[model samples]
Each structure stands twice: as C-alpha cells, then as structure tokens.
Target: MRTNQESKRRWRWARGVLGPFAISVLVGGSVSVSSGFRESELQCEEAYAHLEDCCGALHGAISCTYEEGCAGQTPALDVVQSKCIRKLSCSEIEALGMCDASAWRSDAGAPLCP
Candidate 1:
C-alpha cells in the first residue's frame, strides 16, 4: 500500500518523463505528415507544369486533399490527378479540360483515374 506522498511522487516522476515523450511523439507525427503533404504538393506542382488549362481541376483536387475528412482518401489527390493528366497528350488534356472544370472522375473500367 502506497502512502499519499509516495503516490504523488510516482505521479510526478511519470509525468516528468512521459510528458516530453508524449509531446515528442505528437510533434514527430505532425512533422512527418506535414512534410509528406508538402512533398506531394511539390510533385503535383511539377506535374502541373507540363499541363495547360487544367489547373482548375487539379486545384480542386488539391483543395479536397487538404480538406479535414477528405485528406484520408488521398494525401495527394492533386498529385495523382496531375500525373494522370500528364499521361495524356496535349489535345486529350485540352479536350478533358474543355469538357468539365472539375473533371476528376475515375474510370469505371480502370482501377485508376481516367
């Protein structure tokens, strides 16, 4: 049986050690997530450079990717979408852009975005 004084001492010691450890764990996780998001954004920007008249759709995807609940789906929807656009020829990109502004629909037949 621990006395009140001993319990308080144990609590203080645990807090002293665990407080910083918990904060470090949180901060470390935050740093990695933010860095990963930034990296993905950078890649998206790079992919966007090769595209023209498609920023609207790509920007919309970027916005969604950063949205609170939507972030879980794809940390880099813009990057993935832009990469898909990059795979198309200039005429195809132009056609897709002219067809819809937020044309971010996935192909029914394909596993990835069309």
Candidate 2:
C-alpha cells in the first residue's frame, strides 16, 4: 500500500542504482578473454620462447583451451617438452630465445641430442 508518487520514486531510485551496475557487468564481462598463461613464472625471453614452442606443438590444444564451455582435456607441459625435442635442435632451445635458458634447461634436466 504505497501511494503512486512514492512507488514511482522508489522505482526511479532502484533503476538508477541497478541499471548502471547491470550494464557495466555485461560490457566488461564480454571483453575479458581467459588467456590461461600462468603468472607464477616471470616473463623472460626463455619463457616466451617456451610459450611459443608449446603453443606451436599444441596448436590444436591451444584452440581447444580457448573454446567456450570446453570441459575436455587440456595439453600438458610434458607433451610440449617432447614436441620441442622432436622439432627443434638442442642448440636452438639452448639459445636466449628460450627465456632464462639456464632455468628451463636445469628444470628440463633430461639429456638432449649430443
């Protein structure tokens, strides 16, 4: 039992508050893409190189990663490492392009081509 004038005022106040919030969420949510690059590691030359190599191996996998509402398996680092060895020379991987080559090499301690 509110009067017509009071009802109009309340409606106006609710619209003024909720309208902008709803619009902002809709607009902002659309622009955000989940580029699943993990932030735990620093962005170094080696890291970028590794990312490029990994993404190259899992080109299909990367596309799968970006699919909407995708629930299937994602590519793993080991797969990328195997592909890197198969596709690129050890010297190439050892180069500065592989961001913090020392760290990656040490971590990927497996023997490469002599």
Candidate 3:
C-alpha cells in the first residue's frame, strides 16, 4: 500500500516536472514557456535567419550549372548550405555573413569543360 507520504512525494515530483507548463485542466490552458527556453528559441531563429541569408548570398554568386565547369564550387556552396549554414557555430555563421562572395566563386558563368 502506498503511504500518504509516498503519494504526496509523487505529487510534488509531478508538480515540479509540470511547473513550466499550464496548470489548467486538459480542456484548455495556456503554457508559460520559460524565459530561458524562449531565449534559446529566439537564438535558433536568428541562427536560421543567418543561415538562410548565407545560402541565398552564396547561391546568388555561384554560376554552376549542369553543363558548367565550375561544378567543383557547387559542392563547396553545398557545404555552406548543408553543413555550415545549419550546424556550424554561431561565430562561424556570423563570419559567413561577412565573407566575400568571391571566396565561394571563381568566376560567374564560367564555361564548363568539354
């Protein structure tokens, strides 16, 4: 048989776990996201925005196409899109913002090798 003390302990633990969430019934209630969690979400949004900008900026300068020779750089920009844009550290993402487009592209519309 569970003692009253044990029941109380379980309730307390549950309260602790659910403290960050809504206290209302399941029918309807508002959740209070912790400030720290909100801040993290904001940071993620900012990072994503920066990453999107990086991809856009890089893709704009790239001249690679199915028939082009600068295809080598396509992989490089893909690196920026798949890796750097999403997984790189914030400082690195910031650096990408300030990077020169020439570094990612040798020449615009360069002819592909036959």
Best by TM-score: 1
| Number of clashing pairs per prediction, in order | 0, 4, 1
Tally clashes: model 1.
0
Flag regions of model 1 displaced more than 4 Å. 39-114
lDDT of 1 by residue, 1-111 (tens): 999999999999999999999999999999998776555566565555555344343444332244347435543345676577567776775655533434444432212
- Which residue runs of candidate 2 sit more than 4 Å off their true CA positions? 34-114
Ranked by TM-score from best down, the candidates are: 1, 2, 3
lDDT, candidates in the order shown: 0.57, 0.46, 0.45
At residue 66, what lDDT does model 2 achieve?
A: 18
lDDT leader: 1
Candidate 1 has its poorest 10 consecutive residues by lDDT at 104-113
Model 3 clash pairs are: 69-112
Model 2: ten consecutive residues of lowest lDDT: 58-67
RMSD in Å for all candidates: 9.0, 10.6, 14.5
TM-score of each: 0.40, 0.33, 0.27
Candidate that beats the other on TM-score, 1 or 2, i.e. the better one: 1
Model 2 error, position 110 (Å)? 19
lDDT for model 1: 0.57
